[model samples]
Target chain A: MTTYYTKSHEWIRLDGEEATVGITAHASEELGELVFVEAKDEGTEVAAGDTAAVVESVKAASDIYAPVAGTLSGFNTKLSDEPTLVGSDAEGEGWIYKMTVSNPDDLKGLLTAEQYKSL
Target chain B: MSDTLHQTPLHALNLELGAKMVPFAGYEMPIQYKAGLMAEHLHTRSSAGLFDVSHMGQLRIAAKSGDVRDAALALETLIPADYAALGVHRQRYGLLTNDEGGIRDDLMVANMGQDLFVVVNASCKHQDADLIEKALGDRCIVTRHFDRALIALQGPEAQNALTSLCPAAADMKFMDAIETELAGVSVTLSRSGYTGEDGYEIGIAAKDAETVARALLAQPQILPIGLGARDSLRLEAGLCLYGNDIDPTTTPIEASLAWAIQKARREGGSREGGYPGADIVLRQAREGVSRKRVGLMAEGRAPVRAGAKLFADAEGTKEIGVVTSGAFGPTVNAPVAMGYVATEFADVDTALFAELRGKFVPVHVRAMPFVAPGFKR
Candidate 1:
């Protein structure tokens, strides 16, 4: 499994054709406390840079873009009941959704952990 | 973003408390701290929360005649509130209206017997000062207090925390103001705040602001809060933010603030129709406006934030209103918002739809002050 990061602060863990996505810790910290989270329904196909989800904090709302073109297979429904988990454990249990990639080659263009940290 | 951004007297103390700094209204202020907005908001409701609101502008208005009533009567020409009738040591909420009956700014005016103490929004302070000076300069002295710093101690436990430092604070009712000493420092204390909580807004010398703030924070019941919580608390209270909820495009009658304009200033009263935009404001008071601001209760968890257009139907064909301020209320345990809509749709429980992220979501028109105020009065 390899973790890939995007300039917009979304991170994806890729394994074979399956992938899990969530916001980076830096992004979570910037967003402060999360009050609500919503994403496209399961099986919704989205292209790279398209808005797939939204996260709201007490002060403002922000869009979570799709990291790569893929069909959303599942969502982290727990966020619907416990949105603060995104602020507490954004990288793990707070993962927003799961998807099946249409093209694995798209992963090669994302930044590594080192490059994302420098960014 | 620029080095030119102003820093409050408590800026260094905010950094020491692990605050997340952000630029707002030409000042570098704390948006939240380690506890975040939720914790700070809840704490302010249950206990005491200390807030640094130093960026707001404060000034003194006094007539050359040496009587506060003269100044208040003179100021009545600028705002719609009844200031001449306001008792000494008492404060009233006021609005600065333009010739078109639109709100230029909303402010608090405290009658200090010999002079009137006023506070205005930070973003419009310079313009407001110039307006007052230019309008009333011949009859009154409008002295801007650039050397002052303001702080608020809010919540149910606010009185308890404050009386420990200034014992006389316990005797004050809501909207009462007093020039007193706190921790051996001279400060003007007002038993009023933007939050619906029972609290006090203290104005101190810029040099002594940090000392008084630290003294208040030293109380076990008081925790330092930031602007993020302040905003949520005010939204829950249904109070208007000058630039956001009420602007130059909004009027007192249209914003559901008619109550703030005392009967003495209305038509048929002793002093009638002298303020700016009096013709439109008074006529609206009698005839009603085409659109009016109302509280919005959005269905579901997602917040229907400001800039969301409201419609009469979910299909998003006919637009009726637009949200001014919206946020997730931690105390209310739901998303709450304020917006303007057609007068017919402004009734309580009227169903409206808000377009959020290209999808129209259900919202209901609701009465404001989502949470009841905890004022001592």
Candidate 2:
């Protein structure tokens, strides 16, 4: 599966009409250990660039903005129980929420795995 | 990244762990790991957290063959802790003082056999070293262990986790130091920690530090925690940090640290009491102190962080004191802190106000250890 990254350190995986999303390895690295992840409720409507989650660490709190507008289809509720999963597999199982893209074109502004590596 | 802050050997590791680096005591230290303050705090209560305290200054107080005990006693006169009473393989918390009865810095002292192992705050290392040297120059040898590593493993699972790296650690008691190999690195390991949790502070050679650190990280429940969590964890445990909670302007009596003073020393007849500030300290022990350190709990999400002005309200209208350490209590899930207030407001349940952003935020005197300390001791 082709994985993409956002400047904010989120990753979006497009699986046809449905998509999977989580923080990128870089974001997890930047955020440190994920202590708290307040994910957007399933079915919550969010615009591109809208804050969809709140990630807090022992030192500070940060907002996780949506890379593309969409209604969050589902969230990885398990994060509430095991926040460290974000640190272990931030790009894979650490995915925060799933959403339907409002415009797939919005993904163009984001970075590819290679592009993120370059940045 | 700031030049003003000194970076430790693990600075790059902090970046690898996604630590939020902050300038502290002239060094760049991790304030928090990936987990935000609250979760990191919760994890500390339930599990173990790894803290890189390498920034703290490590020093040794040595006495040639015959003068060890006397030198130790001379050092004890300044700080009010019972050192001679301390058993071998044990440790004690100590405070350094000035000519007047004022605190210099709070430090941890351990008997490392033939010498004394001391750890002082990084910010005050220069002054502490100078003070120790000046006080004992002609008497004994005081050397700096600059090229060493100090890591604290604190929490409920601290002992078990650390024991994995050092098998002999299981039999160790709180405040005891044992020479053991940790993750293959030779180190002087002590079963003592600051978070009020069951743990150890490992002192190892500087060159082999990274190897030892990586080995400890390999254990379960051992997460790379930062200074932010370290402060919050200690505060939640009702422990004092040197600069903020205890400084040159404060005394052990006013800081509610009277218990640290030895009874014999207070009596002045013998053991150790000829050092600086003994007069005022003895007087306070005989009489009573006016202002005392107390815990304050503020209501709401916004933290009444450090430096907030505190006042006794209504009938006892007085600009009583200011907060030394205040922050949102992650464990209590509320705002909690400690500060020095007048006798009138020092009582638990006494109503007080914390000036936050130009407004008086109502707070009440609360019992400290906002969360129960789970020290294995």
Instruction: Say which candidate scores most in lDDT.
Output: 1
TM-score of chain A of each: 0.97, 0.91
The DockQ-based CAPRI class assigned to model 1 is: high
Residue clash pairs of candidate 1: none
| Every candidate's lDDT | 0.93, 0.79
The residue ranges of model 2 lying beyond 4 angstroms of the native Cα positions read: A1-119, B314-317
Candidate topping TM-score: 1
lDDT for A41 (candidate 1): 85
The local distance difference test score of model 2 is 0.79
What's the C-alpha lDDT at position A47 in model 1?
Answer: 99
Error of 2 at B369 (Å): 1.8
lDDT of 2 at B194: 80
Candidate 2 i-RMS: 4.7
